[model samples]
Target: MNHASLPTTDLRARQARRRSLAFLLFVLVALAATLGGPVEPAVKLLDESQLVHATTAAPPVEVAAPMTIEQLRARVAAVLEREGVPGVGLAVVDRDGVRWAGGVGLADRDSGEPVTADTQFRVASITKSFVALGVMRLVEQGRLDLDRPLRELMPDVAIANDWDATSPITLAHALEHTAGFDDMRFNEYFSAADGAAPRAALAVNPRSRVARWRPGSRESYSNPGYTIAGHAIELATGESYESFIEREVLRPLGMPTARFRRSPEYADRLATGYDSPDQPALFRPIWHAPAGALLASPRELAELVHFWLRRGDRGGPALVGPEALARIERTETLPYLGPDTNYGLGNYGDVSHSARSRGHDGGLPGFLSAYRYFPELGVGYVMLLNSTHSLRAYLEIRALLFAYLTGGRAVPPPPPRDPDPAEVAAITGYYGYESPRMQLFGFIERAMVGISVRPDPGGIALEMLTGGGAALVPTGDGGYRHWREGGTSVRLTRGDDGRRILVGGLTYFEEHSYAWAKTRLFALTAALLLIQLAPAWALLWALLAGIRRVRGRSIAAGEFALHAWPAAAGLAWALLPLLFMHMARAEAYTTANPLSIALCACTLLFAACSAAAVAEVVHASVARTVPLSLRLVPTAAALASFGMTLYLLFHGMIGLRVWAW
Candidate 1:
């Protein structure tokens, strides 16, 4: 008849009903927003930059040549269909004017509606270009210059190589991404607070990694560069990044829909992006304001492109002079292109090792967008999609469509095949991934490899390794290649030893390689690891000292034992794993995350706890055994003291010192 035995059937049913009703209400609200929202105008301006006046009126629009327009539409449709793209919005601009504009498919597939030209898709990293343009606006005003030392603008700033040479980084370098800085984008936005606090630190103080090249010596595409650019823009304009962009770029371009909201207010008209169903939601309050955090419909962005195409001739003074626009478009600085790539100010120029067009391709966790303009043919295209698969499809379709627009031929490639035997054998091995924040090793079993991600989920996330691994054909050279669905590529590098292979910066361990023989030696040495005894010996010395200090005292049995071997053994066991793991590591980089060190420290603490418990059990000294028959309490309390010591130890080991040094 107690509370536990009470029936409470009505209360339980009511609670269940409430949960069900709440869930249904959420679904109904979402449905209402998607299906009942008002249809916005095809080209609505949500905001524009007020800083740069748009003195000129919108340039007269031009219809494409009949043949050209038809070809462009058909090509766009084919690309969208082939790639299973849910929807796309395109803006074509040339020297004459904005030549063609349109949208295809549904912006929201779940809503079962077609994408209007105005359906805003988050433009992802294209926001970086806008940020750069804002900085240039200040330069045009004579408020800032291209070559002034950044330290002068904001003293105590520590951008990598900011003040190294006579020709230090200028506004030009910041705008063009030639500032010798490593690419680091702010990711604090993924948190609930959207990383506001951390972002504040990032804005106030920018850093550059120690570089092999000097500032502006070689270009490296850097998100951190844009973040610094935004910071510098703030200093120049006396505004936050958000206010500056709102006042300078969006207000002038008449882009009212663009905003950096933690949650999109126009969720109904705004296309929702999806990675997997459960991809972690990312928040970036700092980054959302600039580098990769703006959202606008393709239709809105088309107007933005048109504005840029017209060189700011929209009823106001030019947002950017024709000369500055030309500078941004031209290759004033080159991000050291790999064997097959090149980048200019916030835009990739020669992505395919060819000179077909200029634009930037943005790919993040749940977004993909490509904004390009072909000045030669006076045709440009903007492709924005919600799915992760959208980029490849968008690029492929765009490339083929470009051929159609340029009067060139489009020939599709052949299908996939089983991998070559030699090629498969060549890549078979254990590979080590040594990034700054992650250290993992994977072993190839036949064609598939299993990776162990320590202290977290340890398995493959994507079935498609290399994305096109199973489809690749081996060339005469040992390397294998595949024409990825997008304008993307993959290449494998082999060592001169002819056995070692490095894929995606990871070293593959091969069974047939000369290094294979060392595995046996490794196993043998592991079995004979008396090497850990050194730490054990040290622990024993400390234990003996504790015993001497407590000589002749009627210490509790648990306390006496804690003054004996438990503390020593605990320290030894903890150091054992860390030592072996360190032996296996190659080098540490600056970008390493703090979690890696935390895992190792946790191991040490757990070992200490185990040793302390064992000592207490052996001693069995306690006044409370009659109640709970416990033996470890006194020793556990002693180890708790060590546990507190370890908290400090861990922080020191894996903190700012590890990085700042």
Candidate 2:
């Protein structure tokens, strides 16, 4: 009876298993049918002839046809929607005149007011071009000379230059940003009292007036230098820079709306600038108006661009003579700033894609603008945006417009030149500039953000220790072009002291020994890592000691203090910057803020604590009270922290007083 029952049960189990597998197969077949089968051939391969043909074939044709006004408008609207730009005003000018002029997005998002062609916006640094026009007008009148020493013309203007005996700063140097002056420091720029005279505004930071290098030797962008040039205009013409520019330049070009300040007529029509959708930008008076502070509508700015493209061939009123305009358009060859680009009197010159273009870009807290003119093509563009987001959108649009204007011919980048290994090695090093423009903080910036140039297979790569980086490619000339940034380049030159000087965009950096930079970087990295990890290690050690105490062992007071100091120092170092950031969010943190004072105090205290911790670890290592393993970690941490503190001290950050500078 038992044998029969077992055989029956095994036969029933085998049948059930077969039924289950059959059902699973049916479900998989149903899923495959529902999903649909692949449409194209799954395994297609090209023959040898097809492969060769594909490799040798020309590239696909690009969209080179000129876009209609409606098409351009649609594209701009798409970009505005995608970028979340609040408002933008645009004007495109051809040889005949404005091809199209209009606005996109909202002038006031809350009010639902659409931006119009006549809506005014802050043009920021584009003001430099107008100021340059004023200076050139004076030059044509023989009231000023570009090459004349500025001090000779405006004796009252106090500028200190140590690199040269004569303190030679010229009008051209000031206009071209080659005066060797440092940029206005945080305090000088933000804490400047409104309604101050030009001289008084400059006096706000006397140290910034001093040259960081010899005048006309290197190009460094300096807003304060432009202000000084504006003052020179006043001295030469006995008229204010703004008044002269308005009467002679703006009025002549039929751009009466283009002025340095908010006039009554254009006040209500001004676009509301924004830092973001939620953050409204408040008005801050620009003391250095000549550097950046122009307000104009897109149409008015296009008028100014038209004047340049015509090369002073204004049918009615001319702002500058043909000869002066030529001088303004010609790019300088001496004291080079870039390989394919140069700063003209009040304009920037660039040869990219085999086309030479002149224009300027402007930026401020909540506004960004650009005006470019391709003289050969007799085409120009003006872009004004009320938001800083998507700052590069205008540039991309410019490129598209240029391609269409050029009949779709691709303007390839300059051919890369083979770099000499020896030359590359000679230039590969760390370079730093003393940013005396930032005053006290400038010293700290120089130490923390030095430029590092490393040799590479193609050429050299230059990087800022603080953040941004660029790849350098040799440009056939004895200079290197930024592989991606077409208009920017660097030249290697010798300083007055016979040391290697790297001349980039608007500043010069003196080369530093690789050995020195490497050691500093290693010490900095080690210290940063140790300080960041101090609190975690300290807590772990404390926990372990507590476990020992629970097992009937107690740690000495000396040992406890040794661990405590590092934790305390680390917290202080980390918390201070965090606190500053918190204040910065509230718009309460500034160079002159009391929080800066507290930061300085905490930094110095941390350094002191770090020094004590180093001593304690050294003593512990010598006494051999702790085991070798325990001693090693503590010793390394202490030494790293101490080294960082020393570096900070050397850079004037440990006990720096922001207000004093």
Candidate 3:
């Protein structure tokens, strides 16, 4: 028994040593990579010489009557080439049926397979329109109620509604994206495989199920909300969402090639998606299929568009009554969020210069598609592409096609709103919205996408610090309309703290002390870089000490402790990105993951280490043992590290458990 205990204790000791060595090695490797040069991405922008054949000339001012198919093909091809899209499928629909259908480029660049009218492309968010139609069909059949609270219908489903009694989530709210649910988190979005069922996919990450605000109070685009709606449809009809939609909606509407699941028969016809003309993208199926997972040929999409143009009538089985169709066409608006322009039930409503248009545009990682119908003109258009780079090209094609069909010029640009320099100046500052839902990474999230309001010609420009910029036109009601996109506006209000709060398009940005926070981040980054040099510093110091000892000089052992603790703290800082890279690749970077729990622990350890380092530096500084110049660097490093740690703590990044929230 004593011998057995001795062996077990030895094994435990060995395991502990192994773990310690593994951690040390990991830290060393992470520091090495961090010090490595920046990584270069695969795709690079093409130069002007490479774009010579892409037809960068201006579009023709007008086209002759009864435009030939060759003319349309040439124009589309030019746009696709110019935009670097690998392939595109187009369908032109009129009152009778699909008038013309064709494709312009390669479906599979490797195989050199040409895209055709029947080649299927992921329709992305356009799948929402189909799901909306399914819900309306159920409503028409008296199987589901649009206004009824979703909790009432699917009692088995778990949804956290803080406004339970006051405003429960309704079917309408889910369809219109006013359900107050957070958008599907990172883990939920990329973790699910193609075959995962709707409810199973949602179960992977349930943190997003909790309402971020009161249901129906604001409109936010939520993919999970629509998946819930689809689940509700299955519960209501006692049929799988796909089967019901296929039989009642797709079959009746003559959209035979349109379906959620990828069939083996159509695999060859499916266009290969690409991140760029040369880079093939993986076919990642959307977990929330009801929101954006349908693959359809341009002609198939055109058929659906044609049916909608006829207003719930396809001369066969009526999908929904005309009244229900009208309701679907009606756009929803909130007092603070403004009108969700052209955003109806899975559709968008808009008035161009010549006709009223209703349709939806969809974009995934490697695909973009648009389906727009002008009911007044009795024409519909479907454009599907395998690359997202084609979006600008697709928009231009839509505008040009509309102009040709309606015999009118492109929609006149909205007149610019008069400049209010005073108002602009007053609002010119940095604003941030920290989402309580983004539990662990809220600090980085807020910092990355903060808003900057700057003075512009019209009134002011609201620019996302990360990238996108849009002009804001004064609406004179403490509101401002988006310059390009009508029906979308932002309302500004003064919070009790005297900070201005901007409410727009399902998001709110409160004026933040961005300057102070930004300064701290810059300081922290500089300190971290310097801290990464600690290993080199230690090695040099050890070498010099050994040389001195060989020369009969004594080395001070106490000096090791003075440098060791701070170096250890610096090592922790270097390890952060390494841990993040591991999690991000697995699509488990969200707070829901166990790895995120480890990350929070690391953050706490870092904070403690930083504090200890600061205390050590202060003690040395007071003792006057270290040179002032040497102390200055370590002092700054420790202070910056402490500030960053505090920042993370205050912003709820440390020890945050999103699942509990």
Candidate 4:
């Protein structure tokens, strides 16, 4: 299994997207789970002592052959121990049967329960696998049209899109994640309405369902897309999403233990999920089960792998024809991570093993899971972890399992075929991401993940804003292949959109002065931070001066005015991280919550304070009584603060109510 997630599809709560959003957007990532949904909680790692994260690149993987089953288990155990993971449940399978199904380490630190094959772990977004199968079943039965307009299917559901008349949303677009929808807002991410209808779950924030661009234009990983699909399933089948999936997908696969919700009967059977070694992450009900709510054992997940390898068939009538199943595993939209790792329906391709493969990776709260297989190779594996902090360990263990399954044998890359000169000419330019997984932080992300493309002798050179460059060599067809490390993932393509958009690995980027955006935004940000330092130092000086005045020493009132007001503004801004860090545990990114309200109010307060400071700074600077250097300090600080206000105003961040937004 290829364990690493695509930058766009990767869960945001606490992992890849969370940290980035937090860093660029007050690292509010600590505010909740990852960007995809509740599964990827975005927590600032305070308990670093308990969970050593994957900050550095993993050790190089080798495809050494003839690795024994015992060796595989040993290696995985060593990785877990080294990385301080509590436990994991693993299952390896081929067309024949399961080669292994077991667990390692402590399932519960307090209880001393070891992880076992039957230990139930929340599979997070991998629940979508069942939904995908269910949707495909409906397609097979001619009940749900994959390409029919979603508006026609469910007129009751409201979705705002300017291009609705031109490009309507469809079931295939939802399943494929090309519906052009923004992810759920902060409030929606934390919605824990147990037993709520799928439609009601969506009604938490209908505004989030608005499309940033035309439907089916590009793919951005969306948690609610799956949720919306669940609602459509209910409409089509005259059955609830949870009931229908359990009856049609799970039972037919003989996964008796697989379920959508928690039950008292399965209490002891569940693994204790953890965010840290001593700190357990308690399970909370999420609004939509289709997005990330499935709970299953590793043994049951093994059956899921078998179902995929068998081409969506489960012993009896095939859930989907071989052709439809094949369609689900092939990427038609932009690349997710690379050409080889493009996303299909609920499934995505993975060539990290140097062989053609299809699978899904998921995360939520204290759990992480992956379901993968090389259909052509007829082998795959399923992994479920009870801890979220052990990504380094996760990657290493996944690599080892693949080595054991494939005997370290490699597959060759396909022969190269360059795009037509006209096509290449049209695509080579700067582009910015229109699809922000977190809409509140969209402007920040545009600068973060934007890229500049240019024609290269090989094919195209992709330069991302956050460092790293790739040469996309063409691999026949219209798609461009991307190779990184020893494996290839994702692809770059001008997608199904009529706009002739330049599309590639992750996010939906449109032509823009992305380089200019990155350069100007960073420049302004740096200038503001640097300017704030003067006021920060002035505040400290003012504190000492105030003490001296109390002791009967004289100091100029002009200097105090210059220092205090701008200093207050800087301090107010600085206080946010500390306050946010304190509130991280509460995940207070919602608008209704007092803390969330305060969070937004504080930003405006900073602006208001900043505006007031500018006038005081002007008066202070013109005062002949104040020293020239001291006068200069607050003047520069005020200007920077004012500039920042305009920038924030332009991007609509001034009065941002994160949760409601």
Best by TM-score: 4
The local distance difference test score of each candidate is 0.46, 0.66, 0.67, 0.70
Off by over 4 Å in 4: 1-66, 191-193, 312-317, 331-338, 412-429, 454-461, 470-473, 477-502, 539-557, 621-627
Which stretch of 10 consecutive residues in model 1 shows the poorest summed lDDT? 48-57
Residues 592-634 of candidate 3: C-alpha lDDT, one tens digit per residue: 6666665566777677767876777777766665556555555
Worst 10 residues of 4 by lDDT: 47-56
RMSD values, in order shown: 17.5, 17.6, 8.4, 11.5
TM-score of each: 0.51, 0.80, 0.74, 0.84
Comparing 1 and 4 on TM-score, the stronger one = 4
Q: After superposition, how far is residue 23 of candidate 1 from its true place, in Å?
A: 44
For this target, which candidate reaches the highest lDDT against the unseen true structure?
4
lDDT of 3 at 281: 68
Task: Give per-residue CA lDDT, model 4, range 348-405, as digits (tens).
Answer: 6555455667677777778888878887779999888888876676667777777788
Tell me the spans in candidate 2 whose CA falls farther than 4 Å from its real position. 1-66, 191-196, 314-317, 329-338, 350-354, 392-409, 412-475, 480-488, 492-502, 507-512, 586-592, 618-628
The clash tally of candidate 2 reads 2
Candidate 1 lDDT over 1-661, as tens digits, reads: 1223436885466356546533533443343344334421111111111000010011111222224656666656665677665666666665555566666666666666666666776666788778767777887898777667665765645655635665566556665555655444223223334424213645432433333244554443445556666777777767677777777788777677676554446766766554532222232233434667677777667665566555655453368888877666664543221212234455544223122345665544445676766544455567676645434454455554455455543323333344455555545444432112111111122223322211112111111221222233433233332333212122334433343433321112222322433443343333223222323443454465468668842222223243333333334344433433332231122234543344354445444544554445544543332113222333443344344335434434322233232
